[model samples]
Target chain A: DVKVTQSSRYLVKRTGEKVFLECVQDMDHENMFWYRQDPGLGLRLIYFSYDVKMKEKGDIPEGYSVSREKKERFSLILESASTNQTSMYLCASTLETGDNQPQHFGDGTRLSIL
Target chain B: SQKIEQNSEALNIQEGKTATLTCNYTNYSPAYLQWYRQDPGRGPVFLLLIRENEKEKRKERLKVTFDTTLKQSLFHITASQPADSATYLCALAPADAGNMLTFGGGTRLMVKP
Candidate 1:
């Protein structure tokens, strides 16, 4: 079975703080993604990395950035946390098998910005 | 202008009955449509995937149908148990190389005993 691990299950941060959410996958998948899920918004992609040091912006990438220094780890950075940034953050990884592969996901980190 | 839409209302059904969920999309062509199951406080889990060339796909008691003309997909669960209750999300992946996905607001399913 594939395992994707997020560093935190729940996190709280004050406004204007820098927050980091970490994710690691054991499957060594080449593609990793960061998404923020809000009520009525579903899962909107924030950023994705196809390979080490390679990143792409998704639908909603404002105020957020990503780092993929290694294959197993992907990190989501909140430049300046705001109350509007509070949402359930998810990390997913998948093999580079063209476009037919299913993404394996972590449990997610519920972020709260006060 | 691309959009993926799923029923936001929770679908309530009796146990041992079949439950169907709907997903619709517009303004974009996807090479693959995928369904995922997400419990409360957990990330979505991949359930099934259907390609644009295929009309239907099944796994165990779960079935999915895709219609490109209508830009809709239906997910069915036969003899559903309470354990089958969860939010189901549908995602559209374009025919391009990357795994870019556009997801819809998931619909929650509640199985009553």
Candidate 2:
């Protein structure tokens, strides 16, 4: 079984503070993604890393960035947290295409910005 | 712009019945479509995947159908139990190398026993 783990299951931060969400996968998948899920809006991709040190912006990337310094770890960074940024964040990983791989997700982190 | 839409209304059904969920997309042709199950407070778990050329795919109690011409996919859970209740999301992968997905707002399923 594949295991994707997020650093925090719950987090609270004040407005203007910088926040970090960490994710690690044991499967050594080449592709990792960060997504924020909001009520009614659904899951929107924030950023994704196809390989170490390579990142791409997804649909909703404003005010957020990502880091992939190693193959097993991916991190999501919020430059300045705001109340609107409060939502559940999910991390997922999958092998590159041509392998017919499906993404494995972490439990998710519920973030609260006050 | 490519977009995926799933019925946002919760689907309520009696136990031992089959529950069907719908997903529709527009603008882009996907190489494959995927269905996922998400329980409250947990990330989604992959359930099934149907390729464009394939008409349908099945895994135990779960079945998925893809209609490329209609730009729609249907997910079916047969003999559903209360444990089958969850939000079911449909995702699509573009026909390119990256395989980035576009997801729809999920439909919540409630199985009454």
lDDT of candidate 1 over B2-113, digit per residue (tens): 8888999999999999999999999989999999999999999999999999999999999999999999999999999999999999998988846777889999999999
Winning candidate number (lDDT): 1
Clashing pairs in 1: none
User: Candidate 2 clashing pairs?
Assistant: none
Clashes counted in candidate 1 amount to: 0
User: What's the DockQ of model 1?
Assistant: 0.82
Model 2 chain A — which ten-residue stretch has the worst lDDT?
A95-104
Estimated TM-score for each candidate: 0.98, 0.97
- Residue A99's lDDT within candidate 1 is 62
Runs off by more than 4 Å, candidate 2: none
Q: What does DockQ give for each predicted structure?
A: 0.82, 0.67
For candidate 1, what is the TM-score? 0.98
Model 1, residue A71: what's the lDDT?
96
